[model samples]
Target: MTTVDATAIVVTHNSVSQVQDCLSALLSAGLPVRLIDNASTDGTPALVGARFPAVDLLVNDENVGFARAVNQGLAGVRTGSVLLVNPDCVLPPATARGLVEALRDRPEVGVVAPRLIARDGRVAVSAHPFESLTSVLGCQFGAALLPVPVRKLFSGRSRRRAYDACLRPGEPRTVDWVSGACLAVRTDLLLDLGGLDEGYFMYYEDEELCLRAWRRNAAVLYLPTVSATHVGGASSSPGQTWPHLYASRLRFFARHRPSTFGPVRLAVLLRALLGTALALARGLLRPGPAARRRVRAWREIYRIAAAADRTTLSQPVPMTSRSPSCT
Candidate 1:
């Protein structure tokens, strides 16, 4: 067996229920772990200290968002590689070792992500080509809402093919980016890239990181042979994170693709408007708690998208100024 020289870094935010399992799996794999709790009010830090005493626990006074928290964890990493696994993800020792081995074998690959299996036992689509204007608009328009055939027609066959390739079990394939739910990356490469972009509060940080890695000539590899179970949306609910999702998407486009920023912004605004109208109709027609929640979420998304270039809801401090307090 290949000995894995990697420290697992899990950023937790009220992930009390999932962190136990997540840490257990990493420790069982004999990997040193560093967990950064983003001011989780549900006693997540206490639980980790009590249950997994060996884990280096870093507690934040406020929720610093995913990218920043991960950067905080990266600051103290002494390992050759770092595993950025979400608290909701559980991976076997072999899978973790395989990720490290992939990096060991391929000097050109900076990031390697395992195939993510959803809680329902379905292979999740974790890899994707870098976002273009059409892809961005397709996602903004909610391609998943349509049937598979119609979705291909609406979102383009390339998107469907990309998803299909990611879901299909095969050899390691090069991709634009992989989900951050579980990924292993070289420590030196990550630090050289200046860590994850702190501008992203929650979403799109993984994409931005991969984009930077590619810019630095480091290939992002997707390994289907290695798989992990990802309990998606453990820290926050979809309704609660919709605004952040759209805001991060706009921020990503504005920074990377300046020419398409205007179109992407317009698409986001239209999508938000459409969602708000639909949610309002649903709330009026149904008159239930769920419907009301949908209306509120959609309104928040619209508010964020309408803010022009300042789409991010909160201002993030520079990564250099922040450091994790390890215990």
Candidate 2:
């Protein structure tokens, strides 16, 4: 097999120092890196140019969202595999090599993700099942009722499974999907799947890509043996906290199930409405702050999901199956 020539793409804005630090880790990992600056006033371009002269840089005038910026950076990448890293995620020196090895050894794999450890050494959801409207509901709204372990079990995932397997050391193990942060994807496969769907500005774009890969009969691989620390939401703005993710969920809904806006979309809308009503009634009777907050948050999620249905009414979706309500 040929050795993979990976290109590391890092997107940056005002946090030039953080980006530089992140790039240091990637460089140490021994990969040719590309830096894409999305219209930052923080002198990130100047700092990166001066400090890492050999790095390829793209400077945009405005913050053109993560999907598009990374897509632009991807256009210049044509050789081997492509590893996309969030500027805030500091990868270990061994990470790049391990990820590349996993992808190289696993011919069936389309994307590979390393286990994500928090700075404090806790595993912070390294991977997730392919998200559907029901999967999102079960995890988001049902978290109180279904704890992490139970949730993973219901979702058909191995929580405590070892990352290394002697039998399938170089083989691809099927996973719901791999995460976007510090993910290594086969460059050609990514291109064939059309890379990141620009429709999704941030959230769920990686999942969308993996789903496309799934449709094309490619496997999403997760290697616990290879690890990286994803300081969660590192590049996102403060306003992007809960609200941004809630809004972005709609983008995901639209991309995966484009037929929602038609008669099928109305069915989803009605389901969401009925579910929200039941949640509100339960909360009102219970009279607790937690229940009330949960009800409100769930309302917002479904509202956005319904809205996304409206936005993509004209597009035609390929296929779908039965989905559960979020409430």
Candidate 3:
């Protein structure tokens, strides 16, 4: 029965079980929640209404993407603080209240990111440093080149250090950027900063928002006292989502690091091309759905990379289960 001063903003896209669990957790916390349905084909709206009648629901005519859906929810928030929660993430008790307290206690902090625990019980790299050309390259393709065990170890190390994921749980530290999957920020500051940049349909939006906070003299704090169990990537396939990830990375570089943007873009494109080529070769020999999907994704990414003008490739390539080679 402990109510938090912040309102929870939940964005859903074809979510069923995860949405139920997310809403149940928020309602259990005695927090008011605003749910935004992005034209989900599933009867998620009806499910929310029937299961959690107290929720303030907004159903969009079409999928507006993550950042835009969050913006819509933010518009309806009357509370001083807002917690942006993804449908796939489940919150722990006192999580929202603790985050609100952190926001109130630290006036300099604009965004508070919680520790994200994955389903396998490993802590995900929710908080990360500013994406430089080097960091982006390392995160995207660096691990794939290594042996399976070494790749896992190397990625774990990089993720923990780059995101400060190993920091003590009780203490709060000003960090670069946190994942948008579950973040808390003052309503006023969010509005003043114009919320998330919609240019990014999905990935990198969080980093851009946190970077803006830093530019505006507000600290992006990582709070380990509270945590959320994130079932990451429930909504999109890895193959389908990779392009948006890289494209957003390109956009981020162009906007933030224009001086070296051209070279960075070239390097990103070359790396992507190489990946696609390898995937295509593997799919031809092995012939599996996963491998074929990977090839298709990289091919589309190749188109984006080889584009004469980048603006034309703004629309995100849809996530499809069918393999391009099979068709």
Candidate 4:
């Protein structure tokens, strides 16, 4: 058995259903696993303590977002590399070892992520180009206004091609960013970069970290040779995650592409307005549980977007001398 010098870190929150399986796979593969529970109320900590006694469990008093919790686990890493796997992701031991080997062989690569497979056995789009004003607008209006075929003619085709390239087998490919759900990164590089930006409550932190790695001359490599099953949204729902998703997107633009932040903010607000209107209309016409849920979700999104400019919706945590090490 080939053992990789890496610590698998899984930051979990209200992930009782998935954490056991996630930890089981890693431990069965003979990997040192550390689980940082972000104040899970579902007895997740207790479950881990009882079932996976070998896991180095670190329990937090509060739900300190995903990035911060991961950093907490990273701080105690004694290995040369760290596997940042989500509680909902099942990475095969071979796949985990493959990621570590990729980083070990390529000194220039700071992070190597596996191709993510959905629970339904479909390949998930894991790598993406950095956020831009055009891409943002296309995602917002294009999907809502244009038909699927028509939308594909414009931005979808290019985006599809990029995703397909990331899914191709064989040699690792350099990408702008890979999903942090199942990635192996050099421990020294991750610590030197200061870990993920805590300013983001959730979302965009991975992309932001990858961007910083690139700026520091470290490549983000996507290895399609190994893949992991990611049962996404295991810990949170759309209602809980949508606002942070939008806020983080704007924050990414503000920090990396300041020139586009203003336009991106405006586009986000417009999206909120349009979504709310459509949701309301659907509710009025259909009048069902699903429609009501949609309306409520869009209304909450609009409420947040409306306050984006005046509030700290998009602002990140204030950087200090040694803080936000990735930026």
For candidate 2, write residues 1-327 as lDDT tens digits: 233478888888776757877888888766778787878898889998899877888887777667777777777476568898988788876778777877788788878877777778777665656555555554445543765556545553342232222112444356767678778888898777666766655667787778888888888877777678777765545333344465556556665555532444444445456656876788778878756665666566566656654456325332112111111
lDDT tens readout by residue for model 3, 1-327 = 766888898988888768988998988888888898888887988899788889988888887777777777777467889999999999876788888889899899889988989888888767776866665666566654665345345554445554444344657777788989999998998888777777777788889889988898999988887889999889778897888887777777777877656777787778778888899889889989999899888878877766624444333332222211100
lDDT at residue 324 of model 3 (Cα atoms): 16
Q: What's the TM-score of each model vs. the native?
A: 0.92, 0.74, 0.86, 0.88
**lDDT pick, better of 1 and 2:** 1
CA lDDT of each prediction against the hidden true structure: 0.85, 0.67, 0.78, 0.80
Give lDDT tens digits, candidate 1, residues 22-44.
99999999998989899999999
lDDT of 4 by residue, 1-327 (tens): 677799998988899999888998999778988888889999999999999889988888888788887787776577899999999999898898888889888999998899999988877778877767888878787664765445446755446555665555656688888888888888888888777888887888789889989988999898988899999989987866888888778778777777777788788888888877887888788888877776677777767666665335445553234212111
Q: How high a TM-score does candidate 3 get?
A: 0.86
Which candidate order results from sorting by TM-score in descending order? 1, 4, 3, 2
Off by over 4 Å in 1: 147-161, 310-318
Error of 3 at 124 (Å): 1.5
| Prediction 1 TM-score vs. true | 0.92
Displacement of the residue 43 alpha carbon in candidate 2, Å: 3.3
Model 3 CA deviation exceeding 4 Å by range: 144-170, 308-327
- Among the numbered candidates, top lDDT falls to 1
